[model samples]
Target: MKRIPQCDNTLGPLDFSKMHTVLVDVDVFNCGAGPIPQDGRDVWHNDFVKMPFSLSSYMKTGYTKQTNTVRWEVIYKQLRSLSKKTTASVKDLEDAIIKYNPKYKGQWSFDALSSLVKADPNGSNYSPKLFQKIAELALRLPELVKKAVPLLKRGHPAAITLSQTQIACLLANAFFCTYPHRNFSGPKAEYHNYPSINFTSLFGNASSRKKQKLRAIMHYFQEVTAKKLTGLVTFERRCLKETDLPNWRSSNKKMHKLHVASYGTIENEGKGMLQVDFASSWIGGGVLGSGLVQEEILFIINPELIVSRLFTEKLGDKECLIVTGSQQFSNYSGFGDTFEWKDPHEERLNRDEWARLQRQIVAIDALPFKHRSEQYNMNDVTRELNKAYCGFKGHQSNEPDIATGNWGCGAFNGDKQLKAVIQLMAAAQAKRGLAFFTFEDESLKQGLQQTYHLLVTERTTVDKLYSLLQNYCATQQAYGSAHVDLFELIRINFSPSKSLL
Candidate 1:
């Protein structure tokens, strides 16, 4: 890490060129091997009908040999009738969904939805009206998917651009359970890797947590259908080949620029920078089910991102999803069970060359360790290194640095010190800087800064850091009763009195 001279608080930004600097050798990083070869079978063919969202496409629907049996006329007529109503009851919505998805009539549950409406702050006043609006919007799914490019799973670069209105329409369909063959589960299930696109999960297994989530989701529908959103959003899935992976064990790059803060969130403080979403491979994670953490919080506030679940397959370790131009439609307070929908947000960000919003978020799911000890193995460490590197590696030199913090540290129970070092090394290998938000963890802020300073002073290479991790892991196992602190282990190994002095 190169340090530039600073100016007074009242002065303008510091001039970096004028500052004294130490040059260190830069190492080229590579991940061994290329992406795994796929069989001739296409993953999309296993799950999707390859049907585009269009009125004509749905108009001719009949019982085909396909798993999903949707009668387009039946759906259109039911939605059309619901659209005419100023208010709709829970039973009416259930009947409409059953009309289209007769297969799950008895199996499906709506306890959560019923609870939500009953627990509504405004009582029946909002539930009936909101259900009516969602039903009406869902009727327009044909129009929404009319131009939606099919996101095939062919391991190639592709993007789907759609408006907020289009997203709302699709979500409304999700609410009505219009998507067929999506309700089953098993190793042989067609859409196993994909998160449940239908709202069935949210409506079943009623609990206080479910009620709160419905509030946020219902609020999202209320806003979108109330006004047609005017911006375009694009979801791009980027797959990295073995040629693109870095040789992590031999990287010679020093740490890049870093900014650590004890306060402020990645979304607010790291604006204009590429934000990292600590996600589950299944995309929305347990959001629809019963899990909420950093990833779920992000999806709830920027609900448009949830639509990605419809097309995105489970992310491979070498792959990540880059969402651009998705607008924030609502503001919220708290996390998990405490979460609440606050107010409608007005997005003013400018669009980019692709007509997408300037906002960019990269979704990378870290390995969820059931036991803390499971993450200390070398193979596990390498997997995480590759995962973070895959997301942090930049395609263009001009791309903004990453804005991330406590990536897998929350519910995933990751060690913050280990994750921070992994991200630092990955970012360094990619020649990009980082803006890490400690999420108000003061101790982590100071510990990371001190450890980073020591590594820089030692001119430590990534290989050296990796070697140190090996020793630390061994020590942790040997001393089974107590866990070793990573920064402390490094300090003891490279003490100034023993080495630098």
Candidate 2:
């Protein structure tokens, strides 16, 4: 029988004209992500989809596939050990590798492992098994590591470089590919946003145009080889200053750094004015109740202690500032107002207890200001300041002689407001260093104890939120790119002084 070519209108060896256009649709259920056949359910006919392929496809296919089961198990075990706060050393890496496969324990010499990679005669070829694992694990490991270590300081040299190394290592290990060379200006390389690697150079040989394009794309974006790693070193170098990185325990008096952040009040009257008098009108006692006196209290009590804090090796150097700002206060009474002539109760707070409570209140005076002045120092400031006294402007003829509840009993209002402020201050202080007990008064002590826990809890929540936003933006590619929006996910870490204040 002779084979005949098909014609438009006649059925022969092949004919489409007589075939009916039937839209055979099948809803793909738990099958992995792949191109749908005309009939759809021929999924089993195709090779099983990759783990990530299946997971990503689930959003569209409504598939609940048990993909990544083995990979995740391995990754989770590695991460569980890696999550320790202690610095990861070469020993740790060696230990992990030894455990990964016992057969390689004695044979895995560092130089031997390094030399195992061969120059491909046909260009940089990668093992199929390695490439698949690298691409799959790359998407998941960072997320897990981020959870275990929430704060990654870019200023730390090791920290700044670690992200790039991790990305490169994961990809290389998975693909069994030679690590990309580091030559920033090479022809085949293009730098992206990463600031950790010194210079990444990706290479491609005589492959098909599409393959070359894929290689370029992978190196430029997916792989860590096409990013500027040394840019971070430049950034850190630019940030260094005289006040940063000093020996704290040094006996040299001239080099002794003062780290205080506060304002100077020359007037003796405001020295013991007490922060309780500064609560705003909403609290009725105004300035006295507002924890607005924090800065003043720190200065009056001991300025040097605060100054010593900011002048540390870890903190980048910044100029000291002298603040001259208004410190609001609420007026309780004057010469014409009634004054208490005697004690109201037989059981009175002892002098020591009263002093202790007063100290606690004073310690909290700087809380509000800390919220705003974190990046700079405010201590050297000589604030020619004034007090805003809040109360009723005029008196009515029908009004009772005694102050109304709306006006707020000055003493009670002052105490409550002071308590809230001190609580915040104590909590902030605790985060910076070991905190001291200042609440000696029974009443103030109770208030401090109750509010302290609340403030601490709130601080933790806010820190987490800020970190999430910061990390998101840092990890994600800049807007208008094909990369994941991982950078935008980070929350900004708040400076204890500025945001809270």
Candidate 3:
């Protein structure tokens, strides 16, 4: 047998201070002009924005049960009134938001905003003047959406392309809580399946965590409002048909390139490659709620993605969101509860044929297990294989290898070994290499290398591994304590001396 190429397994922590930082100072209005070429309309989805929320749609002066009372004219007046001020207090911003969301007057808190201001009296992140600037930018929401295309919930594949500056305008509106009827959640709610879009949650919760979140968001507004964003970004929601799915248990493909590392995040280390966002089926997960993990961290760093919440519907098992060219506005430190905004990141990736950046990200939500044993069910296993394959499969032959690690293992409580195998199988079928980031798990790095070496040496096909998993799962179900490690199971069944000989 030929020697298989060893996977890259280097490990280390990301150094944020080393990242390049650029000064933001572009003419936002001039750049907002439609960069769409004459053929740009051809790529737009026909039935996009099934439920359109135009600038004029929610505008109303008097209160009505059916329509929003927070009129656009009223919002414009309040924001415009504050535009001339050199600085505005947290109370000033809160008052403006309350005027629009009268229903949540007493319910909402602004302790976080107050704390941010107190934390750094002289810091630009909490500057009172910056609040006024963002408020001024938020007022431009009317103009930004004036000629903007609707992003409808169509049954077929569709895409929406817009400039980063235009996205900033929409996000500014989100920051001010302008989108009506988006705060609620339930089965019958209009956007029940979507993550929350409003920034009210981040503003109210006064804590070390919320303060860090505020820093990231504030930095995003400062950059967009100050500079002329110069690139295009596309949000594509792909729905995979049953025919498109690979038959995992019957596959004959060998393992693609494998890299196991214990340090560095997929985003920084995997640059120029296809990155995976461990997302919720609903997309952003609890980004606007309280859930912060891999998915939330990705969104906060690239705030432009948050706009997808305005229109993207919940994804099915065979579906995924491929975001191309979204810009990263801020640098962040820590993970989950300890996440904090560090500094700015200047994106330097070359542009693609579509005028977007070369960066590509696929969002694939993993199954959340109530009990660890529930994941052992073959039905669930197959579902995960299909989901990962749906995201890893390349639309173009030139697509880069996938960069992922411990997907669905964190908040979802998935077993890392099982998920690693699942992703490897899916990537093999897709014919793409895998760069797995164990995120400082040294044991995983060594175990994965040994297990993969065995699989390569014995020429173990996907079907054979699938069968092995079946027995392992059965044993797990029948005798819980008799549960065997995956690598150990493979060793016992196909020891190198016996299986290879």
Candidate 4:
């Protein structure tokens, strides 16, 4: 079998200077940096959290006829009973989850959980032990996260940074479906725009893919519960207001460095660089459901990121989410339907000043096109450019260069060549270098490298490329069904005219 390629060291070096990031404190880079204040106008929305640390927290116990009680105190009795059990069945686990989430009783299914347990129902690794550990972790949510978690609401440029332990505890709660008011989703739902949080959807869908997803998630609980976890992870929602967006029609920026390769992947080869996630408008697109594409795969491996769905609002077109210091727990082979969960990934990365792993990821969703020609419309092209720019633009001068490739080309029905050029232009405008990963597509690797060479040789500026795109869009519309290669057109436009002696 062919070995995995090495591209992490090739992407670029890490700059240790104090680059301005989305950290709450400008100077201090720790979770303990400052006091997390309550809702101060447009800053934070702590009004929604029902956890013990929030003002909205209340106790309800048998006040009416000594029967109605909403206290979590009553909820812990069932969780503790399940945790102490040495031979709990999948049925017992489901019963316990439903006891706490009574509203979802008879509504949520547990087929996936039952199927996973049956695979090794009596084994040392599966069943009783694994199921029990998950309950214990879920029970510790209130104790672990003593501070209220603010919803990373819409139209707000804000962040919520939590320690790895806090993230693990939160995910454990999601696994047991303990979050309140999060199960409902629709037009009138409180968080109608956000992705589903509870793991009910994941637990109900029984398939080989679901089994693999459970393996990764279960492994995370085993590791975190058995050992001491460290480091901080942050989720920042960045919005590019209309005025902050670049005037793509007239910009004089030039492309920086380019390293195109057909081998290696974004997470592997692109390590330590600003990795780009080809995400959906709803972050972690269908991770807890039937979908298993790029975005879903990303969230599964790094379960820490799955916690974002609990608070992050649905992303806007001009917005992106930057995750700093998330650790990859498992590695896998295959893409889409062929995906399989490989073994554990030893955390070899060094920690930063704030105890976060030396890792950064930016999530940017591209337009999903039904018909390929729809992307060539100038309005659509402009939107794509701005979306890429929103993710690529540097928060500070010392940021690492970007590592990406074929961003919206897979299930989104995007043209690979056009997507590549859009990213190039966005990277150039952002003034950062780029390392393009072709995911073993040699042809794309060659095409991208040649295009980069031509663009650099002629010293093509961003505005020049923008003008070329305008003409290409017009050509594509006029030609109708005929396909035009974007790179070939660039060569024709950049090639020096025959010298007339």
Candidate 5:
């Protein structure tokens, strides 16, 4: 066997401070040419205002009749003021709960459940345990909501509160995990690491204080405060930083979006401002499901006006203009014309573009592993590999290759490039402090690592493109001499090396 080339690792430290700040801003575009709504309120149609609140409240209740009654009556009245709107059916609610928890669907009646809800005006008769169970079961409502009005409605406080609170919980978990670990000393022994709740520890124990322990843990998280067992070390004060853009500073602004444009207007009492959007829908609040990917810890900053025209643009009530953010802001305000605005939805990448971008994403994924490797010069390999991957889509076919001439996109050598992309992803996850290798659920990471090694054995840096030719030649040479299939030589060679020696 030939010696494998050793990997190199070396790189300058990356500055992350610039990526730490983020801002969130939002504006609603008007569908009609009218004065913008004040106080950031978007007007929903009648269907939105009249969603079935009473039924939703009923769904929140468990077997208890009394508790469901009061809640039902309150929501029914609220629902009456607006035109009828469809809400999630009782069956849908049940399914949502089952999906959320993967348990508790078998314990209840769906038809009788509705009957109990209709019969009772209040859920007061239910015990705290029942109420708690209902709360747990109803946790999935937020995920099912299609519109924002019902989420913001006053009557459905439980769903609204749960939705908001769940979002908060998710954000809080992310924040907590971002911080460095701590040191602790206890009766059992000294320990070091982030303070984490051991769900198994609580679940496995059969002690009498189990309920009390659970409550205590919940209270700690709710309060965002640490409690000490021996009155010595605090557990909660150290949480994730509340910074807006911790990762953006290290990333390219060209790649990271500050805002996406969509159409709408901002109007006050008499005057209206119009904006043409090039980006799609945007929320001023921080984006969820970011930071889960490589080379970025995503968060929403205040939105920017990608394109806008003032109120007096003489645009027809139905027409809109889309502009780029680089355009001057003063161009938007005018006097008598009603104009509609829409962000550039057309700019969103098509399927082929997305696939190409996926290659870049994979490249970004490899960066963290590169930085963490024991090899120093290998760091350049990581960055250059990522840069090449990200740049591949924008490159003309005639451009020189970064790794090899055959390494261009969609070439036969693409399999090797794709393998590199996978390797980079594993490296990035490792850099994010995740346990990539040991985690069974991270199949992407595992598969990438396996494929890289396979390619390594099948080919080499020295052989590069001609490794296949070399292997085929060696096999054909044996066949030409013996006039037997290639397998016979391999079988004879494998039959006891010690006896042959």
Candidate 6:
């Protein structure tokens, strides 16, 4: 199917050179970081994050009583045993992981893993050798990533760049649930601020979603172990400083160029553009859980992105995560309940100078509302706008445009036209263009095109649009539970001449 993108831009593709990445121009790999030093944040042996090789003394495992046996020793003994095997059953893998992580022995379930192994659609491609290969990779955690990974904690802006080999190693560790002190949660917990790192959550609660998710995840391990993967992936958590947050009520910036269409997806049509991940505040959302939404599905296809769950903390409304160079491993056929792992994705995207895949994704969670009326308030409106702006803001000159559509509109209950305007305002504020995919909603595609045409035709600026939203909010309040279409409001107010859309 040919994608006929609705082109509002009269110009051709702009040169994407000279765009700044989170990494510095230096080849140091960890370049361009703020307070963080040349070596990445090393919190090994600390309570914040317990690495596989952290000394038993540092980890303070109670087992140190007998001739100084540490936690990692027991972990490696079990993992080493698994690695020696040419093949293993799902039950064998579960038993090995339980030997190290005995705390969750009864708490966790491997029904999902077993189910995948039994009915895995990949047939021979998904075999027990893949599990043994994963164990071999998991045992190399201490070597593949020497630098201590700092948690992309809330509010602190930082970036981590690691080779795909390094990513594979870390994910391999995650697959085995080897990382310590990360399983706990809540206010008093050490890694309470971070997302779940272990694959324990994924292995439980057997369902169709988990089966499909495992297919993609297992495919990733198969590919990484089958070949010596090259390239790098960088995860940068961007925070909107109080000074950086735009005063939407005062700004006069006009709408940027928009290419709207009903077909294509952010990953396809928005390639080479800053792709948007309609994320949850807790980062990867429900990818580890039963969720199979847009965000979860995105993480499923690009399993490397799932690695961010290991170190990234919950995202604040003012913060967003920009991932560069992560490779996509599988193709899928549907969204949500209908999602199925189609096949392996031939990752042909060009690599950047840093040897990272050129693909970039921004994770920004929107305000989830129980009722659509909750979003009309100016305070919530400003929060969503600022959130998108934090992700859309340019780090350097000649940055690529944003590729997104219907963000926060599906399960979050966001009004389509309103979110569209909010994103348009953010892109304009960030000085980038936008490519919006309506995902086959012809009504939304037609409505959005008409509304955008009116906004552009009237030469409306961001500040002016913001003020109009305020008016619409008030009108919505006065009208009570009755819903109002934002495009209708914009058209009625801006289209004084009754221009045909």
- Model number with the top lDDT: 6
Which digits, one per residue and each the tens of the lDDT, describe model 6 over residues 48-79? Answer: 34577777423334565655456678778888
Which structure is stronger by lDDT: 2 or 5?
A: 2
TM-score of each: 0.84, 0.16, 0.87, 0.88, 0.20, 0.90
Each prediction's Cα lDDT score? 0.72, 0.23, 0.74, 0.78, 0.22, 0.81
What value does the lDDT take at residue 82 in candidate 5? 18
Candidate 2: global Cα-lDDT?
0.23
Each prediction's RMSD to truth:
10.5, 31.6, 7.5, 5.5, 25.1, 5.6
Worst window of 10 by summed lDDT in candidate 6: 12-21
Q: How do all the candidates rank in terms of lDDT, highest first? A: 6, 4, 3, 1, 2, 5
Return the lDDT, model 6, position 211: 90
Candidate 1 structure quality by residue, lDDT tens digits, 369-467: 777766776777777888888888776536787899988987787889999988988888877778999988999999998988887787778888888
Off by over 4 Å in 2: 1-71, 83-86, 112-501
Model 1, position 77: C-alpha lDDT score: 76
Q: Between 1 and 3, whose TM-score is larger?
A: 3
Q: Candidate 2 on 170-278: residue-level lDDT in tens?
A: 3333322111121132444432111112111112121222222222222222223333221000001112233442221231211111111122221222221122212
Return model 3's CA RMSD, one decimal.
Answer: 7.5
TM-score of predicted model 1?
0.84
Best by TM-score: 6
lDDT tens per residue, model 4, 322-415: 9988999898888777888888889888766556788888999999988888888878888999999999898753668888999999888898
Using lDDT as the measure, name the better of candidate 5 and candidate 6.
6
Candidate 5 C-alpha lDDT tens digits along 1-501 = 000011111212211122111011112112222112122222233212212222332333457665544332432232222112233333443443333223344643344333333333243221223322323222322232223322111111111111222222222222111111111224342111112211222222233233222222233232222221110000000111224112311421111101111222211110111110111112111012111110111111101110010001112111112211111111112211221111111212111110110001111112222222111232333333333333222112222111111121111112222333322332232221111121122443344344344333332222221232234335544455333322232223323452357
lDDT of 4 at 407: 92
